[model samples]
Target: MHATKGTPDATRFLELLRLSVSLVLIIFAQITITGFVGFFVVFLPFLSSSYSPGSLLTGMKFLIAGFAFALPWLGYWWMMYSLSGNGRIRGFFLLLLTSYLALIFICMQIDPVYNPEAMIPGSARESTFLVCMAMSAVILFPFYSLGVYIFVLRPVKRPRKRYRFLLLCLLFAVAGLVLLPFLWHSAPIVYPGLLSFPE
Candidate 1:
């Protein structure tokens, strides 16, 4: 009797552990994808031009900035996932957020080519962008949490279906798109220079 009783508990614990590990893997994958995309986009412009010491240095700076920008979001996602206790919901939210971030970063990279002033480090515009990104994160966190709670956690008359998750994802994507312009406007410019670069 005791052995049978313990089996289910042990199995449940193992299942929770598996979910936790899977979430961590997803987070790491997100970070890796963002880093690769950032590096490639930043390096793309230099490919057509003659190699210069400055271009090489700029590429390295972009890579570092990409990682720095992504690390905070990783923590935020991990915390949200742990709190939500719904791997599917967490995955959806992370996907949405990562896509939004990648899009913004790509735009930032392209913007500097036409308007060099946009990428100037430590400038007011750059600072506003960072502030806006941070603000977006703060604003979206609760919205996602509540969304998961209402859509997935709360009891409903109808049986929960996979399509509901898809719906939630679509809704979030739309909301993200609606707010993206504002976010992008306030987004910190990623310059091809080091943090210590003279203002």
Candidate 2:
């Protein structure tokens, strides 16, 4: 078997972009669902207490959550724009998506709303939502993964400073996973008066 080493296919990279766009759209749809249709689910026993156990989770609530959850993935895609190596690009994005989803699931378990009964400590309904979302995200990974590889193959040189910033962002990305638990645990206590549906 011969290994091919060179620039990635531009068409394939475009496909990854499309996949990323689709994932973003899906996240938006979830925002709408949790916002507009969430009321019914919120009223339900497990659904309400499951993820939004702390306070009422309105449409806006899910919108922000979805955006925040998707940020890491989005940031990663953006970061790829800076580099021109297809292999590194693909590997990095794959790592980013996987790591981001992992952190989300971990936070769900650590947070309150996800698992209300406290039957399982460090596990909640948020985790369940993330698990499902990650499954959906899995469908798009291949394209984005290919994009990363394509990126690495491209011919270009990065500035030293930009490289530094990319490195910083990468570090931040890793730190996000470590810090997510603390953020989830402290968010409610830090900010009371969570938003709710109109009375």
Candidate 3:
């Protein structure tokens, strides 16, 4: 009788599948919670009684902002799972963090004014750009550092030159940082207050 390594292999595969499912569940839950909070807090009050372009635009802003709020954490997990290499992960994390902040800048530019009372956890008019940027750097740095080293792109006796990969990461990070400010500054068409929420 031959003993087999099949059981351990099957168990490992199942574990990986479980982790993937968990990630999906986490994303779904985040989207749902953000959607509800965003609706009452940011969207509802903004809808208008009379249909208008401004109101439509405002509604769009809410949806975009909600997605933007959800993107960073999702992006983090996505990158964490997808890539392997400390330099690459660090670069990806930086780039993703930059992009996430860019979205915040986008939301700031949309700058829809809403009544505090209508919102569940009310928002403020000021830009959260800096805050998001700071948070991204602080939160992701350690994770990026730890993750890259742990996940093997290909195990090595000695590390190989990965300058090109590092350069690419830098380029992405720089591009994200540079373009976000401009995108953040562009003014939007209208504010749809009251209709989205209520009196």
Candidate 4:
């Protein structure tokens, strides 16, 4: 009954949640879900018998989290862009590599990567999570494909009446700008660096 109360948390092959009418809602798959996924992946590796607020505050872990968080949105956009026939496969690698490099550059500006500890050992919950991930992906493949195609891929492919490439540039620029603040806020929290955040 509780599961039936709210909306499905994901539309792209991972219905991990049914969002309630609370402050935490499933609004932007490109941001919200992907970002959460990134944070969690980093976190799970770090979780162990001992936990402190500061356990997750290492540089390498933070970088991995950033990559994890950013990947989904980047993959969503890039994958769609690739299928759109707007450019060659070379362009896809160029964009992905460059953007990821840019992200690394920004992080380096704040603090360089440092792997200070070994990963926590496997736990009982790992199996549960694996099963859930596999099942959801298998079950939701069709919906994921359809959702991305209808909402993202089609519009991407439709740009440019005769090669002018009207608004595609602006669309990407906006997406980049929107991603910056998330990366920014997350940096200080995850890495606990130059920026001083409130308590």
How does each model score on lDDT? 0.47, 0.42, 0.40, 0.37
Candidate with the larger TM-score of 3 and 4: 3
Per-residue lDDT of 114-173 in model 1, one digit per residue for the tens?
234555334433333333333443455446545554564453556573455446555655
| C-alpha positional error of residue 35 in candidate 3 after TM-score superposition, expressed in Å | 13
Write down the TM-score of every candidate. 0.32, 0.27, 0.28, 0.26
Q: Which candidate should be chosen as best, given TM-score against the real structure?
A: 1
lDDT of 1: 0.47
Tens-digit lDDT track of model 4 for 91-145: 3343334444443433334332223352843332232222222222223333333
Per-residue lDDT of 50 in model 2: 45
Sort the candidates on TM-score, descending order: 1, 3, 2, 4
lDDT per residue (tens digit) for residues 13-130 in model 3: 7767865565555445444543454444333455432322224443344334433543444454445555543434434444444444443444344434445565453332222232
Residue 146 in model 3: lDDT: 38
- What is the Å distance of residue 195 in model 3 from its true position? 16
Positional deviation of residue 164's Cα in model 1 after best superposition, in angstroms: 1.5
Error of 3 at 187 (Å): 5.6
